[model samples]
Each structure stands twice: as structure tokens, then as C-alpha cells.
Target: MHKTLEGVQQSATPAIRGPLQVYLVVLALGLTVTAPSRLAQVIAAAVFLGLAIDAVGVRPLRWLAVPVFFLIPGLAIILVTTPGHGLIEFGPLTITQGGVKTVLDTLTRSGASIIVLGFLIASTPVSTVIATLRRAGLPSVLVELLLYVYRAIGTVFVEAERMQTAAKARVGYSNRRAKIRTTKLIASTLFLRTIDRVTHLDEAMRARGYAGKAPATAEAESHGYGLSIGILAVLLGVRIL
Candidate 1:
């Protein structure tokens, strides 16, 4: 048990002990929004910086999917809603030069933000992030959920890879029937496994004296407050500039 715990700790170290590269990237992101008409240049710079940071091989790029998934669609919505002078009119369908510009700007800015966040996830460990969030005053239940979700994603991927490999071994790349069967197997397995895990986790938590309320730790509260203030200051400065 102790050895297993140590192994887990070692596996989690890359995320916890790295230089504050994520923080620096975030600071740069905050500065980019203030770059006036050079916004596109700033966004491009941030993206390159983030990629370079990831290229150091400390963090995997796949971890960035979460932020990109959320940011791209959000920017699209912002661009669609922004008011502008209509440049193209086709009955009710109008495309304004200003709207186009707004969309471009939003896309650039949001993409830059997601890149910075991706860099952070790549550099930081899931354990450290959970610790940070807990320390930052998030409820313990939420922190635990975050950790479980992280682990669950890894579980799902492993299941997927196994199914794919099995399919490939049986049907070479041409077996569409094998591919579909393998995919269904992976999906059904994940769903069942997830349900079982959630049930077991809930039971274990209850057995361990969990109640409806999450206990607050003083250290976590202080860290959360400090981080909240720092983030707010950075955002305010970005808007002001």
C-alpha cells in the first residue's frame, strides 16, 4: 500500500514541482488583451509561447482539450452577439465589417486564453491542481469530484485504446464491423465501470464519516482568498488597459 502511494506521488510530481510556467503564461495572457490594435500579434505571441512551453516535454498537449472545447464556442457566441455596422445584407442575413472584426478579435483573444490554460494543465499535476483548488476555498466535495473526473477520463481512454488495439489485431484497418463492435464495447464498458465506481466511492465516503457539508480548512481558505484577489487584479488591469 505504501509503495503504491509513493508511486502515485511520483507520477504526480511533474504537475506539482515545475517552475511557475503556467502562472507566467497566465500573466502574459492578461497583458495581451491590453495590446490595442496589435491584439492579433499579441495572441499569436502567446500561442507560440504556450506551444514552446509544452514542447519542453513536461506536459502533454492532449490535456488542453478541456479549455479549447469551452473557449472556441464561447468566442463564437460573443462574435455573433456583438453589435456592428452591417457590411453585407441578404434579407435577414447580414454580415457587418465590424461584426467580422469583433469575431476575429474574440476568436484571437479566447484562443490565446485557452492556449495559456493548456500550458498550465500540461505543466501542473492533477493532484496539485486539486490541492490548489481546495486551498483556494472550493468545497471538498467539489475537489474530490475534480479528482474523480480526472481519473475517470484516464480510465475511459485506457478502455478506448484497448478496444482499438483488439479491433486492429482482428481486422487489420479494413474491418468496419470490427471497428463498430469495438467502439460499442468500449462505450458500454465505460458506462458500466463508471457507474460501479461512483457507487463504490459514495459508499466508501459514507463509511468514512462523510456528511452533507464539506469541512473547511484554514490554509485552504487563505490560499483561495489570495488567489482570488490576484486573479481579480489581473483581470481588472486587463480591462482597464
Candidate 2:
């Protein structure tokens, strides 16, 4: 269990903690967009946040994949949905100047935010993230779900890799029809295997006294309140100003 948690901690390092850094950066960007008068102060705050993450050992560009998967798509959605004054029209597609500007600003801000987050995740450990969440008053159920989902995905990937390797070793190059048949067989096998593993895991959890709820530890409840409060204050100030 410990090894599994450790491995998950490593894998989630870039994706999980990166968001926190991104949020901090976004706070600055928000102030810049909404309260240009406070731009200098906001920039200073952002710099301090960046430095703090560095002091805590966050790595840069560790969670780049997350931005690619999440931020870009979200920006695209904003661009597509934003209403515009008729500036460019083609058939049914009309883009207003205001919409274009909105899209551009959203994309730029989101991109920068994602980069900041990616850096943090690359540097912070998974265990520390869980600890942080616990400190922030996150429910144990959510944390346990996060951990289980991470582990389950890893297990599925390992199983799939093993199946692919076995198939390649036993079934030499075949015609298109044969290949399709082999692919289907592999897919079917994988599905069945995954179901079996889930069943076993469910049974094991039950045997080990898992009652649909994760127990919170005292350590998780004892996170640095002052730091959390400071971060929240920054976030709120950005929203208000």
C-alpha cells in the first residue's frame, strides 16, 4: 500500500499541484485585467507566490500535459461560445470584435495560468498535495476517491501493456482480417480482465474494513492555517478588485 501510494505520489506530482500555482498566477492576471491601478502590487504578489513555490521545491513544466488537455480546450470553448458584435461573418459563423478580444484575453490568461500550475506539480510531491488538501478541509471521501482513481488507472495501463506484449510474441504478422480478429480478441480479454480486477479490489477493500468512507487523520486536519488564509485572501482580493 505504501509503495503504491508513493508511486502515485510521483505520477500525480505534475498534474495535481500544478493547479495551485496556476491559480495563484491567475489571481495576478485577474487583477491586471480588472484593476490596472493595482497592477504593480498584483505583480509583486504573483512574484512572491512564484518564489514561495520555488522555495517549497516545485519544478517547472512538469504538468505541461494538463494544460494541453484542459486549458487549451477550455479556451477554445470560451472562444466558440463568446457572443460578438458582427465583425467577421462567413455563412453561419459570425465573430464580433468584442468576442475576438474576449477570446484572446481568455486564452492568454489561461495559458499563463496553466504554465504556472505545471511548474508547481512538477516540483511538489503527491503526499504533500494530499496533506495540503486535508489542511484546506477537503473531505476524506474525496481524497480517497482521488487516490483510488489514480491507482486504478495505473493498474489498467499495466494490464493493457502486458496483454499487448503477450499478443505480439505469440501472434506473428498476420493479414488484415487476422489482425482485426486479434485486436478484437485482445480488447475482449482486456475488458474481462479489468472487470475481474475491479471485483477483486472491491472484495479486498471490504475484507480490510473499508466502509465507503475514508478516515481522516489528525495530521491532515492540522495543516498551516495561516498560509491557507493568506492564499484565500489573495484569491478573494483578486475577485473583488
lDDT of 2 by residue, 139-219 (tens): 988866754654454445445556656877877236677666765666567656766786688788789997865443322
Q: Can you tell me which runs of candidate 1 are displaced by over 4 Å?
A: 1-19, 25-81, 132-241
lDDT of each: 0.50, 0.50
Reference-based lDDT, residue 15, model 2? 20
**TM-score per candidate:** 0.45, 0.42
Which residue window of length 10 is worst by lDDT in model 2? 58-67
Residue 39 lDDT in candidate 1: 48
Candidate 2 TM-score versus the reference: 0.42
Candidate 2 regions with alpha-carbon error over 4 angstroms? 1-65, 142-241
